[model samples]
Target: MITIYDWFGYELPIKERYQLIKKVGFDGVLLWWSEGFGRNYYRDAPQIVREAGLFIENIHTPVQNQNHLWLDNLDGESLTDCYLQCVADCAEFEIPTMVVHLPSEDNPYNTLGLNRIKRIAEKAEQLGINVAFENLRNLANLAYVLKQVDSLRIGFCYDCGHHYHYYPDDDLLSMYGSRLMALHLHDIGGSYSQHQLPFDGPINWAAAMKKIAEKNYSGATAIEAMNWDYKHLSAEKFLQEAFERAKRLEALRLYNP
Candidate 1:
């Protein structure tokens, strides 16, 4: 199925966003599981999306202060608790997967982070949910955390934009494709992590999709593109373009050999 993120740089009401997503021919949506946008929206988004007939693919946890998971302080401990709550929130909402980032910028991996991730994973396992750790600037930290936390609930969320901008040469799909549970498909060009629609940037979609198919990934073709660069278009027009790009990506993934 094809899915798009709910907040693609739109400031419309939450219900209107989901309706537009459904109206634009998307089968599902990726939600942000945080109150950073708004507390009522966070609490009501799952039902709102479902009412619009779009199944939620996954919910991305808050990224702010994610680096604290590695530090040796109360903040790290607090972060762990926050993640644990996120896992529970997934279960509460019946969302299957929760996407997370290991560290922001260049934070080093540490035992504290691993332990906290383990705690979050344990809760997810008990609640029958998946915790998908996403790739960021720190590849070593992602590698280390996935290796250290050996759980069925623990897996990877591949962000193609981050891959292209941060470590384009690294064959990340070949490395963690087996554990890939979710996707954050977007493009980057001219700047850092622009999150542009596919083909809008210079990323080789043919090559990326080929690698993803080679890994035997068969999950939702989900786009995390934002409207930062395409603000001139109306919301419906933006979603129409996103839906078309997603179909193009799926075609590449299926037809590439």
Candidate 2:
């Protein structure tokens, strides 16, 4: 069944974070595929999450200054190599999906990006994992890359906050509706991609939620939001609010498609 998940970070330690997320009524946790501190601390992630009685929805690949993947000046190893390692790590952890972001708007959609996605798609196919490319400021380029790859292993990850902030006039879900594999559910206001809790921002939740239901999306209804905006609220209070909001959003899944 499609379920809601929360983003799990190393903020409050692994076990504690997972327990907190589970207690907040999240069905699962989305993990970041990090090799932090050079010790491969994430090697034990699966076990920790499992012990916390929470399932992992997917893993997010590294994206720090990742435009080099589509740049021509990369001498040898580039950020794409790290992302590939992330894919391998997800396969090893038995995670079914991984979310990826492309270079920022500074980089154009070119052959290099296409080839890299081709390679990643091949690797994902070999390992039986799905690679869902996210939309940032380069929706057209992403559409181009997706069309070029033309493989089942590759799909789209729609981020509501990003769409609200970057391409309010564009219908991203309609563009890649059939290829939808994942979601980064959040809310945003006029300009910044706030990643705020839904209904707190100005996005048209009714229309967006209707679109999601219309697509008949049965994958993870993952909330990619944070409580940083509500620093004054206690951790327990914030989580309770988040859980309530998630429940409201999940109810939208029942809308007639």
**What is candidate 1's lDDT per residue for 84-160, written digit by digit as tens?**
99889889999999998888657888776788788888899999999999998879988998888899999999999
Residue 45, candidate 1: Cα error in Å is: 0.5
Root-mean-square deviation of candidate 2: 2.5
Off by over 4 Å in 1: 38-40, 190-193
Worst 10 residues of 2 by lDDT: 1-10
Give lDDT tens digits, candidate 2, residues 173-209: 9889889989888889523456788889988777888
Instruction: After superposing candidate 2 on the true structure, give the runs of residues whose Cα lies further than 4 Å from its correct spot.
Output: 1-11, 35-40, 73-76, 190-193
Global lDDT of each candidate: 0.89, 0.76
Q: Score residue 51 of candidate 1 by CA lDDT.
A: 96
**Alpha-carbon error at 139 in model 1, in Å?**
0.5
